[model samples]
Target: MVVEAKNTTSPHNMNQVDVNSDDRRDEQVPLLLQYWQAVSRYRIGIACIVLGTIALGIIVTLLMTPYYTATSRIEINRNQDKVTNVEGLEAEDVGQNLEFYQTQYALLEARSLADRVVRSENLATGDAFFQTFNVDPDENGIISGSDSRQSSEDRRRRFELAIRLLLDNVSISPVRGSSLVDVSFRSPDPQLSASIANAWVAQFVDSNLDRRFDSTIDARKFLEERLAQLRARLEDSERRLVRYADNKEIVTLSTTRDAEGSTVGGDTLISSNLAALNKALTDATADRIAAQAQADQNGLNKDAIENPAINGMRQKRAEIASEYAKILVQFEPEYPTAKALERQISDLDESIEKEELRMRTGALTRYSEALKRERNLQNQVAQLKSKFSGERQDTIQYNIFQREVDTNRQLYNGLLQRYKEIGVAGVGSNNIAVVDPALAPEQPSSPRILLNMALAMLMGLGLAGAYVVVSEQIDQTIKDPSDLKNRLNLAPLGSVPDMRKDDIISMLQDKKSVAWEAYISIQTSLSFLTSHGAPRSFLMTSTRPNEGKSTSAFALAAVLSSTNRKVLLIDGDMRNPSLHQMIDQKNVQGLSNYLSGDDDIDNLIQKMPDQGFWVMTAGPIPPNAAELLSSPRIKKLFDHLEEKFDCVIVDAPPVLGLADIPLLANAVEGVIYTIEAGGVKVRGIESALRRVRSSHATIFGAIITKVKSSGTGYGYGYDYQYSYGQQDPLPAPSA
Candidate 1:
């Protein structure tokens, strides 16, 4: 049967195949599992590194000195209490509380505060402070027994050192969403830690009070000087105001004062007089207008109409006139009774006219009196207005002096009040109160064993991962069967484990050995390498010699023969034949003799004793193995062997640095490439494979040989051992 295989020699096909293989691998093997597999290769080294790092951490932790921390908490008020209604020098803005608290926190750690603490505690005078921190006082010239000048200098240095140490060891932590702050101190001595913590709080509070008092002292002095100047200004302005008012004949009547008890404005006596007379003149003019309107009436006035006597007379005249008209109509023109009635009516008319005249005269007199009173009031108002206008002009200067006096008095009063407030505030009350005083801690705050170990473990793992990555990048050998497909873009047939200590030939004979089973699996894979069952005739080759190509060939042949088929194992390497040695046969005559035209192919082939397979050694080493393998005779030999044996496996020479394998590869059905696990680099294998493919040889698949059971999970426990003899140089072509 002709075994057909896909052409994988093209770069495109190779890359496509590699991609498909990688995709399938990615699907089958989880990414994390692949990483784990890679890491497992160096598991021992990683463990060692991790354990070593952890041990180092333990040792260092043990050697470290333990420190105790003590903390004191205090509430800091952003604003102080007001003793009086006077405003303080520093106004507090509600929005600036954050900045205010931040400033307070900064002050808690200030170097000045540290100096105060050191001095208040008298720490610089004693060696106990230095001893608590495990510092040598003599090293820094502190507490030096020297001359007076030197002693003073040493004491100064010691004082500064104490301040520096105090600042370095002190910590300030603010509580969130609160006005509370924590002052903490750390030291090797627990008692010292507590002492320093409490002392820091105490000193900071005292310093705050001192700053308040000092600030008030300056403010008080400034206010005192200002008050003296203002007092003199007040006296001078008051004198000027009084003298101006007197010169202008301006007498004050009423004044207005603001909420601050400062005079704002005042009315003079002339202005008051003018206002009252102007009111009287307006009333008199109204009265005169009413009287004049009554006097100007043409008929009887309202007074006459309302008079009862006038009304009675008008009624009697109406009766008398009626009686006279009746007498004239009845009698002659000169009748006595008619004349008498007319006379009576005339008399009543005279009386009514007189009464109306008297009322009209009275209205005229009242109008005259009202006009005279209005004229007098107008004259008086005009005179007062004239006087008030001149007084107003004069009062402008008086008011200017009055305003100066008012301003001076206001300032003097304000300053006097503020001065009083400062006197009381200068005896400052504490705005910062201690909530919790620090206590000496019984336990050290550091050198946690578990925490150190976990950190060490993580660091060790990081370093180990880096090392693995670098090693993987540097070493590009085929580590497992997956590399054959992933790196070389060739199908992996099977893996044979390393069994260098065992007898490979004896293991091949034993059916139950791991080496035997591995070959059986490889045989099964070879069967599926082509469309037909295992190829009728195939060749095995490697990138370099001793890559287990010969052993693989023999093993496959032996396994194939076990299926009740006549198999032939041919050693195609004429220059370095190893098959005869494996079978304990002499290399007297084989493929070299057949290819050299001896043509006794049957005699050249030898059957193994107690074994079903046959062996054909390279016979005598040929002077030109490449030239001999390239002949058409080798093809005829393989065709003849195929007819005689059911299967034929030619163990060809290595492809690299030799031309024999490519030449012989065409004579077989296909090429079964064998690669030693972790032996040759991927580049070398690719180069070798390329050379073989250059001859158009069909590469069926690849077999990973001597794979470590640990490195690749697919291989068996047994390892196959093989070696190569150095190739003899080809004799110069005969001339």
Candidate 2:
């Protein structure tokens, strides 16, 4: 039977250890390192893809026919150089430079220009032309049979084909921010490429000149027709104007002309006379006003009062009065001297009055004469104005005829001038000029080795990256311990490095082996799984068989035994027992016999003296394993073993396609899931976990087994290392 040792560490102390280590060993790893590790896993496949792509590129490059490219640079001016001072018919606006250059570039690639190049080179008749382009004339509907009509049609087709070939080979590239352009042609023959490139530019220049000359000729013809019409219209207008003026006796004395030499206004003879009479009438009116004012004042005017004779008499009278006054003062009142002085004064006064009267009469006569003169002048002015008004009425028609004549004359002169200019300008000047004539290239341009290689490399890398992403998505295996939490939402217990090739039983016995140390870590983790520290009894199972669950059970048992605890490992896989075979022990009687009501647990249990653990293997294959495991005897068997041993580990069958694991899981305190790295897919493990969880059994955690030393073996991010002393690195196990 099993003898249980005293529990040296209390459950509380064990729980503390478990709690301290409960935090997952999830270290922050560099993303680049993880990516590199993932890529490294598929390095061989990526290398094959890349190398194959590059090899294909090389083969394609070799098979491709060599083609030569010849480039001829040209300068296409927006406006042609003027040969003469006269402007051309087509005026160039500075704002339309973009449109002009675009047009020029388009013309360079024009089908007409290509045809001109083909005809000029006689490429349609030349076999070398068709051969260079790898075109068979007979196969391209260009066959010239004996039928004349068919032959003519074939010739036409061949000509069109040559034009198309020329155009296809030609490329026009314009230099940015400048008037420079490059005309290039590619062909198998270097000389042909050069010839075609040079010919393309030359033909474009010639076609441009022809188009300009044709347009100028058309403009000259149009202008000549317009000039003739305008000339006849002008003559008719001038004749009508002259006849109207003659019939109305409206002779133009003068005329006004604008800056453009067009008639603006005119003056006639009647208008001139009216102007002169108007000036004279104004002068007469002024004189009459002055004379009338003097007459009305009755000689009060200064000029009338200051008459020479009148002024002299007043002075003499004053002298006489003075003498009389002096004599009266000295002599008697009625003295003869006083009387004589008075008579002299009266005579002077009478002389002054006479002079004044004569002056007033002269003023009145002058006023009357001035008024008459003003009236006469006014009458003459009125007559002249009436005549001028009549002339103006007649001049309205004359002015209309005159304006018509002026417009016709202007049009005639303009057309004549433009016609003369077009005649002188001829075809004008060519805007396009070859800057650098094409030369026969020494090297081929296409099938570039380095360029093709680079492109192939890029393509290869793109495909490789896609493959990596797709494989990562398609692969649903548990590659790393993180997959446990990420995919299944289960905590990771510990990872055991793969020791399948090495003696796994010997490694479990040797404490220095990595496998033994990994199990010890799992044992430590299991201790902290619950508040009571490791469950008294736990079931170890996997999604599928051969996932190292049996080995894990043995390893865990050995690890617990090393801690001086009695561990009982039961092979619960009665359907297919593996623990007995793994430990090289006889399986005559085991759990199957105990569950079959043998009532002898001691006889069924065997002690492994080397591993310091007791094992109960699946002794016999039972036809009804699920039913037997479901029996109450299985629960009673685990209950009894719990008291006999410090820890009980049941290695159950795979959870999938079997009801035994769930039944055995209920008989244990918890389930310890053992998953082989990259073995079972995530969905299978999840399905198995679902079945195990349906039993209401506590899942302690999952143990990822068979992990390679290289981080890529599990998931690329897992970097767990287990080294014993100073040993050389182990070789990675084959998948």
Top TM-score: which candidate number? 2
The local lDDT score (0 to 100) that residue 287 gets in candidate 2 is 89
Model 2 deviation from the true structure expressed as Cα RMSD, one decimal place: 8.7
* Candidate 2 lDDT: 0.80
Q: Which stretches of candidate 2 lie over 4 Å from their true place?
A: 1-38, 94-96, 140-150, 246-250, 269-399, 426-428, 465-538, 548-570, 575-590, 598-627, 640-649, 669-677, 682-717, 720-735
lDDT string for model 2 (98-199, tens) is 777788878888899988998899888756788788786656556443334546666787788898888887888989888899999999999999999998
How far out, in Å, is residue 245 in model 2? 3.7
Report the lDDT tens digits of candidate 1 across residue range 97-137: 67788788889989999988888898888778877887755
Which pairs clash (backbone N, Cα, C closer than 3 Å) in model 2? 18-528, 479-714, 479-715
Each candidate: what lDDT?
0.80, 0.80
